[model samples]
Target: MHLELHIKSGSRSGEVIRLNEVGSQLEPSSWVKENEVIELLLRAPAKFQSATLNLYDHRVAATYVDFDENHTNFVWKPQRQKNRSLECLFINYFGLAELSVELEDEEESKVIKNFAPLEVFASKLNAQNVEDMLSYLATLGDEQLHSLFQTTKHGAGFKEGSTSPNGSLERLEHTIDKLSFLFQSLFSKPITKLLPEHRVLQASGEEDLDDSALGWLLDNLSVVEEVDDIDRAHFEFNDRMYKAHSVQVPVLKESSNLYENQVVHGFIVTLLNEADKQLTNYNRTGSLKSAFSEEMPEGYSSFFTQVNRFKKELLGNQIERCVRAIDRLKFLKHSLDKAIPVTNYILDRPILTQKAEAQQSYRGVFIEYINWFERSCPDWSVYQNLLAIKSIPTLFESYTYYRIGESLNNILNPTKKGQKPIGSLMHDIDGNEISLIREPTYWMPKNSRSNESLYINSEGKVLKSGKVKPRSSQHKYSHRCPDVVIEVRKENRPSKLIVLDAKYTYPTLAFSKYLPECTMKYVHGIHNRSNNKNLVCSMTIVHPMGDADESLQSFHSLDYSIEGSMPVSPSLQALGLQLGLSQDSDRLGETLKLLLKQAGVAIPENLQLPLFIS
Candidate 1:
């Protein structure tokens, strides 16, 4: 029997692949049966040499497939003759081809063997024809395109501790401990003030000296000279003449409750105690029986019940302890204020300094604990609402930004082979630690302006100098802010500006097309201000997705041409190129390199391999 391989799907108009020679047909004389092993030589099409052949259950590498003459032979074992198919997947490049084969019975093959004419087939893989295939792949879920993109631990810091048992909870407990210690230290010292004291002067050896002592002395003073043995009385009268003495006495102030530290400490204590009680209640009765026991959504009831049970059983006691510790911190903060004297300058300055430092340190610890709680706890809403602590989105945004930057850093300046990129923690201007940065600074050329320069004042409008004429005394200034702005400077050459914005959505075709319009707006805004059209070289939107269209494209206006693109790969190649890293450029990478070359800086050689590849 002869089997004719039919293209069922995944085939382009000009795609081609070669199979091992079998006289251009599988004849019954050499038909392979079930449980038989056969070697099939296959050659990758010229344009798809990077493609890998995927059998029903195995992947065959095609790196050695010859484009010149002979094909690469693949050993295939057929366990069953039911259904079988072959697929070719090109990496980095796009296009896929599939072939289906069915074995025919001897009687069926003999009926049409003589008159049937065989048709030969071949095709080529190119950029234009593969758009639909790429688009289709883009629509697929991430799991379906697993071979196309790679995932690395290099940039996923949040996930590092995700596997540990109650890791976030443990961290929160530790931070609480630190905060408690700091508060305890602060309250151990109290403030004291000196107050004037009025006390009646008494004879040194008076044992029963009561209110009558002063009265007796005053009575004897009137008859001082009448009595002969009046010497002691005279002395008493003189001593009584001194009346009440004024002495400085050290006294503890009652203003401890009014202090900021005390207030914060009390707040922390109340919050911790409340949380502890709630957690304990949940632990005892289960979350379903606790305050949040209201009927849940249809399908989520069981899932949420299980989650609540885990939180109550696993994290309840630990959280209770953390709350107790926070309460102790309040006592500590209060006690420290009352114990330290306000007049003891030597101890006063240091105490104030320590208090300030401890307050800040405790704040940081609480913030970290809060972050952990928000992530791990099922009833975090209670704590957040009670404490009035708001969760910041900037933290996650900052993490995303840092991961992107770190990925680029690793690609351009890798510390070690196979090292994954890590996220960075940063502090904002208000000393409130945040990861997302509206203005990020780089150590490269100091001549680079910040993203804030793109905007006008506080409004997010592009600054225009002469346009609309200045309103009265108002002056127009550029505040052109992009998410990230990098300036590359070379000796005796003008700097080049590369702008990047981070979006949490997948960079689809629609998003890709919209990015250029946004870039044009910023470019026009800048041009209106400086009248310099050559400042910005490129602008891009970075997102997380796979199988997106070519991210880089050029756009032209009356004054200047700017390149715009969206990078969806997590491997960092797109980011590295945009940041001016020089390497073998292809499409998007080429556009970035060309822009950087124009600025007169050459990127050094570095290994830019994908984190995961099939």
Candidate 2:
């Protein structure tokens, strides 16, 4: 009795295994029950999942399949994440088979015995049709792919905690992660949708079509070193090591000259494609290892072989976009006019004026940059790096000095409206740091509250705090005397407010475990021990490189949890950004801009000193 069996793997494919040549009575063993999940690592196994193999249970839907000897077939059905349902699909045995997934409802049970895919692929991968086989393997399902074998740690630098990607690793890791997902998807789906009863004949699996003509489809990497091992022939084309090879200096002088002439055409299109392939290959197989076009894993060959199909298409699309037409900048200019025409920076404040330095806030800095941006680059392209930084959310205040006008590398470029908010710090009109702010804070809270006091030389030490609720109906939260506070002293411009917080989460700074009370205690206890001045100028409670992760959100709960530390951005900075709103590429772009728009604030511009002739 040929029982129709449904297979259960996380995938949508099937595998044909000899369950047992022993059952001459030919009945499937009850021990091999239905809906049983047999995980073969991340792949499917060699058995079916159903009891009545010929009579369908109608529950299994397939995602992928394994075709054996061009005749026997095993198809996989991916598990549905939402419903927890599974699919049973037919496996395509031959070339360029589209993974067609089908759900087996009770109504389709009558045709259970006819579920077969190899017959269709058989027609495609026949002796006379060897050429199509390579293309078919090129279209290999995604699930069948895996990286060349790097431990999880090898890719660590690309993760959030480590230093950001700079050199080749950045591009490589991106491609690996991208291709991993892409390949995994292919492996997890149905490979062919052959009608039941199709007798797919078996053909010799290895065909002569594995020739060089089909191998060139992967992204065109500038061959640093290449050879065809098939003939044991040594032919060096573009020979150079990648790490030793710098984008700054092309390894091959000829290639460099060619690139120089076609830079605009190269960088965006071929360069990106080649870069994509180079990275993916390096990520999968180490840079010193074999090329990605070599072959899939061992068991992957049984089901489908084509792998880099989508990658090839992706390269083609990029090339078409790059050499086709450079979008007109004038057309982009007209688009910006819809917003309010701010005369000064979007955020206006004195750049480094004494009064400006006196204020410890981000709203002021955002205004300063907005003012600077408009005046400095009235013709600034919409795609500038400073603008890109705004997409990140919480940015380091220090980045402001270092980042400006860097060329846009597409890998790091933020999408059109998705940059991070700007970083915040108190700067003197001269752009010198008067003090550092731990978080982005709104200088003005709705109901507009601030803490002002005249200290009468109190013996008590702790920095006092004020918590004034907002009176304005539009404002919701009350303003608290800055998260931390300091008393005005005689040497310091007293009658002044030193409303700021110290940035602590930074390892360089004291951690949060030493926050509030202990910090306040130190402030009240220490004075005149080191500095010549009798007074400490100002005070603040901030984390270095203030970020929302350090400030607003809890660092403890993140997947990459930082134990006992505050998030990168302070809550105050977030709240203030919420209040005075502004855009910095460091801050996620839209929110910052929205907040900035709401505050109607702008950064102070760099103005020429008033000429004074005595």
Candidate 3:
């Protein structure tokens, strides 16, 4: 395929430059600047019926025209992507091939590309990102990044004891508790039922003349040998000869030793044996290890730390607890060894499954055993480590979470920190604890707040007539959800709220369409139902583009005009901050401090600050 680049803007406007193929890399006449649109024209092989262009596995639309019997021409306007090096895959009926091209914004590209670890969550994991992530994972070693990775996996911290991805292992704890209760119940009062046993005796003794015996004798009178001496007339009884008549009698026997007990006991014994095997195997093989080598991979120290800590803290703890529970269960079963008889078959019948409680408890034990058998093996440890990954997200969103935490940590003393769902507690210079809440859903309160409280979202109501009211902005018809929210709690006053959002693209492109819709909603759309008052003080859009300072001017000029009934000003304010890879890291902290100051929150400047503040 012959490819040509048509520059639509800049000094090279109206210029068409042929992209020279140098091995795998395609060289353009001049470097492509960020946000610089270029019309890519491709001449396909005559034999090829169609062609497609894909960026990082996502298909880009191309305008195609059949140029004649010789070849087909296609034009595609490729936009600026997040990464620096654009690997365009030209897919056709024949096969798949890749073309790599470089851009002018190499530094920004490098920054954005470093987020390769975030690619794991892409709808489709293609070759490009995988290669990038693997290459980057080879040089990771930053302790700070490592710490961030550890916190990001779970909002409540790694040791918070939340349910893990291993379904059966989590259920094992509950199952063990249930089994303990079951064993206790059995030991206290076992299942006892009345049974029947039969006896046959000679009819000589008077003691055997009871009603039951006589009735039995009369019922089988033909067996009497009163005159049956010819056939088998005589029988020895107590050293005396007697008639051959015999009485059959029934006796009621009560015992706890039944088939159900035996079956359950055998099942427990089997679990004990399996547990022993699992423990022995686990002991022989140590805890799950990291996939990467001891030398930290380049650009992926944080990712490595995350995966390692996850395995050690979460998976390791789970395995340890599971083994302990199994041991406890075995001990309990051992105590009942003499009480319940050893059976030839383990769970021969479905007696445990017949009862509701027993069935649930039995399921837990069986599930634990099955999960261990399939996943807890020494060889399966690698698979478990792979499954431990849970952060899965777009790089910007993930980066924004950590970025906010990092930025705040510089200016504020961290009292508490958490991730996954994302929340944190930090004290600013004033010693007041501020909360950073991310993606929290709240039910709207009936009355407007008189004291400090987070803004409540309207979680639709169900009417008395069985109809439902859709959730909206308090009393309004729409609701707005922000990416990150900072709340400053006050002593005897209402808390202040500041909203921050992470946008991967430039503000110019975003505000042109749905971006304004989102920003405007956050400013004027959010309100309290009781008073219809706006809850937000200020909202900032954090973007990755370096030129955001200029592009956001137009967005900042735009505002929503509230009507007469509204309590606040007619115009609401929305600001934009340039943030992300290659962007100034301190910008976010400074912007937040300014927002707080404007909201009348005080901060002490006497404390020693980081040297990078200038």
Candidates sorted by lDDT, best first: 3, 1, 2
**Cα-based lDDT for every prediction:** 0.34, 0.25, 0.46
TM-score of each: 0.31, 0.17, 0.39
lDDT of 3 by residue, 1-614 (tens): 34676767645568875644544454422333222246777665454443445443234545554557876566676444467543222211101123333211213221110000111111122222222322332222122333333333234234342222333343445656766776665666555577776678664433334566656765675865544333343434455444535666676866656655555566566556655655454343323233333432222323333444433443465458667868787777777675654444454333333432354544444444344334421233322323333322233454565566665665554332222222366566656667666643333454343122345554444332235754433443233457776677667555666666665443454456435655555655455444555556766665544432542332333333121233132223233443323334335555555566545466556542442444
Model 2 weakest 10-residue run by lDDT = 143-152
Candidate 1, superposed: residue stretches over 4 Å from native: 1-400, 409-413, 416-481, 503-507, 522-533, 546-614
- The better-scoring model by TM-score among 2 and 3 is 3
